[model samples]
Target: MSTPVVLIHGMWCTGGDWKRVRDLLEPRGYRCHAPTLPAHEPTADQPLRVGDRSLREYRDFLEQYIREQDFRTPPILVGHSMGALLAQQLAARIPVFAAVLLTPAAPWGINAAGLANLAPFARVLGRWGFWNRPYKFSREAAAAYVYNGLSPERQKACYERMVHESGRVAYEIGLWWADWGKTTSVDADAVRCPVYVVSCGADRLTPAFAVRRVAGLYPQATHRHYPDRGHWVIDDEETEEMIHGICGWLRPLEQRAARGQQAPR
Candidate 1:
């Protein structure tokens, strides 16, 4: 049987974001599933409380989902940015084939210096609940935050589809324990699954350097670098090529593992 693929979304995004990736993977005989986060809905009006959520919450959610489904083999957990960090945590505990960390956030934590440089007022807005205020979506700001590398038309459409994220989560990202430092507190060396990271050349939020840094942690893992792609590398014009590259990298490893499992009993 083919191994399952589980796609996890980054902060401020949902499983729907994986639709395109899923469409591309299914034809290859890989069954994919993307689960929604708690307190997040496409049309919800309620505010998400920070105290009610954590990376641990997401880890447990995925664990339970896997148990309930009784997946025969471990799933290949593909995570983007924040979701990548969560995927690492899950792989550390569960049996997983591999992790494709796409433009992943730093496993240590977001750089305090970098955060300060990009959004100097983030702390202030976080503390005062300014981010929680109901303001109409601004295409300009949304593009500035996520799609700086995309065209104006694409940016406009992306902004319309973007959902309102909890200010608490953004604030928590800056906090010490709230980030990967806390999540990876349990020795990262304990994580046994091979991890493959794909780095985009120009991702401002989760830069290529961040992806390179994790290499030392996963000495046995592989890393692929691409030029000029933004954080949304999967959505870029060269997306089909990128997906093929990923599949090429993954298919051989999977075939090797299958052969080993079936070897003379």
Candidate 2:
């Protein structure tokens, strides 16, 4: 059987954000799993109190989910934005066949100056009351940060689907009153699996420069940049192209895995 593919979404998004990609991959005989992280899915029984959340909490949730799968070979871990950070941390500790990071946020300790565009929402980090509350960005802000490449109609539709994100996760990434010791850190040298890093030149949230720096950390990483794409490259007008690029990159890795070549531990 082919190894499974786990899709991890970024902040303000749930597993549903990966539906497009999942649909594209499933028909090709790949089993895809897109699990919602803690506090990401709003339910009557589970209200979102984002301020109390932490990066460690999110990482642990993903780790547990992957462990429960009990796959014959480690799954291909694909993540975006904050999910990318969690994927990197997991790859260091687990044996994965491969990983794909799409416009990933920088690891702990890396300066996120590229996200300076987010300065307009900087007040949320300082307000203590916002710490535990669910946070939502205005449609305008969302468009500027993530949907810049989409049409006005498409952008509005995307914004309408966004949910309140954990304020704590936002602060953690923003380095605002976060516990440095508990933040997720990547040990590039410890990650032995092949990695592919995709960057979007128009991504204001995690700019191309920032993403490139992350790609540099992994000596063996294969890097690709889409100069015309925004942060929502996977959902943009050129989504098919983006999906093709990813599948092309995965082909070699998938072949090696099928040949009984174990991923590096």
Clashes of each: 0, 2
| Tens-digit lDDT string for candidate 2 (128-224) | 7665666777888888887898899989988877877776677677763265574757888988888989998788888888899899889879899
lDDT string for model 1 (246-265, tens) is: 88878877887877752110
Best candidate, lDDT: 2
Q: How many pairs of residues in model 2 come into backbone collision?
A: 2
Pairs in steric clash, model 1: none
- Give all TM-scores, in the order shown: 0.85, 0.92
Candidate 1 Cα deviation (angstroms), residue 13: 0.9
